[model samples]
Target: MSTFLTLLRRDCAQLLLGGRRGGALLPVLFFLAVAMLYPFAVGPDAPLLARTGGGVIWVAALLAAILPLDRLIEPDLELGLFDQFALRGISEEGVVAVRVLAHWLSFGPPLMLAALPASALVGIDGAQLRLIEWGLLAGTPGLAALGVLVAAITAGLRGGAALGGLLVIPLAVPLLVFGAGSLSAGGEAGLALTGAVSLVLLAITPFAGAAAIKSSRG
Candidate 1:
């Protein structure tokens, strides 16, 4: 238990505190940039912005999740950190689990906070904003899990970072659909589906990531 907490703290510092991998700020800024630029790109149609803004936020959050993918597992693998953990009797699955939590902490809540200003920039109403927040809360964990899983799979490959981003986009379509769809009238069911998908991804990520890491090492 103590060891897990230590790993969690170390990873959160590396990801959240900008220790070589860059901070959580980049994703938040990118998210805000998407919101800020979207209004200009689509013209000043307030109704259009209000209707489409939730989807834009969902897409921005997805893209923001990508920015940190390369750093998630690759850096540790390169440094032989996994071997050290193994020597200490730590399983890859356990490390992966800790990483998923840390990665989510690094970006998820901050994105939720950033969403407030982003919601205004995109012209969404308060009711829709509330749905968006709920959707993000439920969905970002899956994003974090997916990011770590992809990073583990692509850790040793050439151009792995770019590959990881491409992989994430297609794989995350379900999350995007349900999360954004939740904002529509009579679409509350979408939020439940989004959370269900998140739970599934979370359940699978640790084992999948552990296998990927082991395979890479072989």
Candidate 2:
């Protein structure tokens, strides 16, 4: 029990402090950048911007998810952290579970906060902002879980970061569909579907991540 807490603590430390490639800030910055730039590219048509903003946010969030992929599992593997956990009789699944939680902590809230400013930039109002928030809440878990799974799978491969990013896009299409769909449709069904997908991914991530790590090690 203590070990699990310790691992979780360490994972949090890595996210909040020890970030190798870029800290937790990178993804948030990327997300905001995307939101900020779209107004310039598409021209300042208010209704058009408001109408398309939700989907833009969804796509930005999705790409933000990809930012941490290369650093996700490979750094821990390269540092022999997993080996130490194995030596201590700790299950890789537990480590991966902790990692998932930590990753979400680093990725989710900041993006949500950034979305407020992003919402303003893209001409989204309070009501649409609320939908975006709800949709992100329901969907980001799935994104985080998917990111971890893809990271584990591609950790040791050549050009794995790029590949991982590409791989996650298709896997995350469900999230994008339901989450973005909720914006215009204003229906609970989309949020429910998004939550369901998130739950399934979260349930399976620990085991799937563990297996991927093991196979990559072999």
Candidate 3:
């Protein structure tokens, strides 16, 4: 228990504090850039911005989630940290689970906060912003899990980071659909589905990521 907490704290610091892997701020900046540029790209059509802003936020969040994938598992693997954990009788699954939580912490809540200004930039109202916040809260865990899982699978491969980013987009379509769809009328069901998909991905990620890490050792 102590070791787990310690590792969790270490990872959260590494990811959030802007080590060589970059910090949580990179994704937040990218997210805001998207929001800020989107209005210009489409011109000053307020209704259009309001109507489409939630989906844009969802897409931005998805892309922002991808930015940190290369650093998530590969850096530790390169440092032989996983081996050290193994020597100490810690399972890969446990490490990966801790990492997922840390990764989510590094970006998820920050994105939720960033969304407030982003909402203004994109012309979404208070009601729509509330739904967007709920969607992000329910869905970002799945994004984090997916990012870690993909990073573990592609670790040690040539050009793995780019490959991981590509893989994340396609694999994350379900979360994207339900998350963005939740902005529409009769959208509570979409929120439920988003949470359900998030739960499934969270459930599967630890074991799948552990297996991927083990296989990469061969």
Q: Which candidate is the best by lDDT?
A: 1
lDDT of 1 by residue, 137-174 (tens): 99999999999999999999999999999999999999
- All candidates' TM-scores? 0.99, 0.97, 0.99
Q: For model 2, where is the 10-residue window of minimal lDDT?
A: 14-23
Worst 10 residues of 3 by lDDT: 13-22
Q: Which residue segments of model 1 deviate by more than 4 Å?
A: none
Model 2 residue 33 CA deviation in Å: 0.5
TM-score of 2: 0.97
- Tens digits of per-residue lDDT, candidate 2, 121-140, equal 99999988998999899999
The lDDT of model 2 is: 0.91
Clashes of each: 0, 0, 0
Pairs of colliding residues, candidate 2: none
Superposing every Cα of model 3 onto the true structure, what RMSD results?
0.7
Model 3 agreement with the true structure over 96-157: per-residue lDDT tens digits: 99999999999999999999999999999999999999999999999999999999999999
Poorly placed runs, candidate 3 (over 4 Å): none
